[model samples]
Target: MAARQGRFGAQPPRSAAPGRRCVMVTANVDIPALKARHPLVNVIEASGVKLRGRGRVRQGVCPFHEESEGSFTAYGDSQRWYCFGCGLGGDVLDFVQQLEGFTLPEAIARLEGGHRPVPVAAPRPAGTRRPKSAALPPRDPALLTAAARFYA
Candidate 1:
């Protein structure tokens, strides 16, 4: 179906306010892809928070709250961040959400850096057979018997 047209004969995406363009995003967002594209340290530094230190983790003042001492930590390798002062910790999406006062979907949209929505797959039918897991290795009968005797 064609998208609903707004003023000036232009089509507006779902959940968008008047004169604002926003695409309707559904569930099943590729979180790994988003994190890979935007690293936690990079995002924090981009926001003008001066981080100090090297390696996987970096420390800086908590941007969520007022403080002079450094209490915010950003894990570059894991793409996550935490603030000890405010007791807030989470991934990049959580950072954007808290910082911008936006909902999860809005945070995702902002991090995506595009107005387009990620493609959503159709829902699977209930009762679909799941794949069998790998079988466990055989146990040593001799060792088991010895353990049982020792315990007894």
Candidate 2:
């Protein structure tokens, strides 16, 4: 009876303000499953790269750079790519990131068929680094004078 008291557990959630009902739905995304199901080859081809056979790897014109010949190689088993022209490589997420200049989350969303907003890098939080105009400590007067005289 206790287990059946609520949809999930015994306690009715306290945050509903007594009259409102709240529901929580979580998706435990299995990355490996997604990777296996959606091959990098498909994603690459969908993005307009024309792949050709090159032994175990598939070769295409380097999407990340301006190249006439095929220099981008995508491995079928690994679901990844590397560029001989630009020397860049990584997994599916990385390829999307490099190709579209989208942030990690944006790339993942695109790969999973989720709605993607404007593709731009996410802003990092401000922390240790100083601003460009941050004042520097006053230089030693003797050192400044010496440097000025040397430059003059």
Candidate 3:
């Protein structure tokens, strides 16, 4: 079967590298502004995901992360999203990135309906993780495992 087309209307290019490709698109399209144009209720309805509450905001299952309880919140006023369970929070672009696994530019293009293609970055070789900051400690595998189980 063909891979599904993402929210951006295009699938991730087979030749595109994970990190090198243009993660985001043109800066003129402000994610916040696009988000503002659509109410949270409308977006939620468009997504076809049932929400628990009726109003400007609603809580529902996070499409990005696994959770038994509804910890994802969509805010109509700010056009932003927050997941207390996963600690992943950001504007609509971020939400699309997390939920649909689209690059920043792809997400923007999908949401804004633009045809301009963003440059794709060269792929990095296998087994290389993003460079870590010296100020941050290495992640604890045990902690991550526990969190994964908790979410599951």
In terms of lDDT, the best-performing candidate is 1
Off by over 4 Å in 2: 1-28, 114-152
Residue 57 shift from truth in candidate 2, angstroms: 1.2
TM-score of each: 0.57, 0.54, 0.53
Clashes of each: 0, 0, 5
Q: Write the per-residue lDDT of candidate 1 for residues 48-146, one digit (tens) a residue.
A: 667899999899877678666889999887788899998999998888778778777788878776632322224334444323335677999998999
Query: For residues 6-107, what per-residue lDDT tens digits would candidate 3 score against the true structure?
Result: 887868545457567643356677655776765555554455444677666778766555566778887766677787888887876676566567777777
TM-score of 2: 0.54
Candidate 3's TM-score? 0.53
* Candidate 2 pairs with clashing backbones: none
- Determine which window of 10 residues in candidate 3 has minimal summed lDDT: 115-124
How would you encode candidate 2's per-residue C-alpha lDDT over 1-152 as one tens digit per residue?
23336666688434544674433311445667767766787777767677898556899777677666789899987777899999999987787778788655556667677533223433334332223435688889999999999999
Question: Model 3: how far is 148 from its true place, Å?
Answer: 24
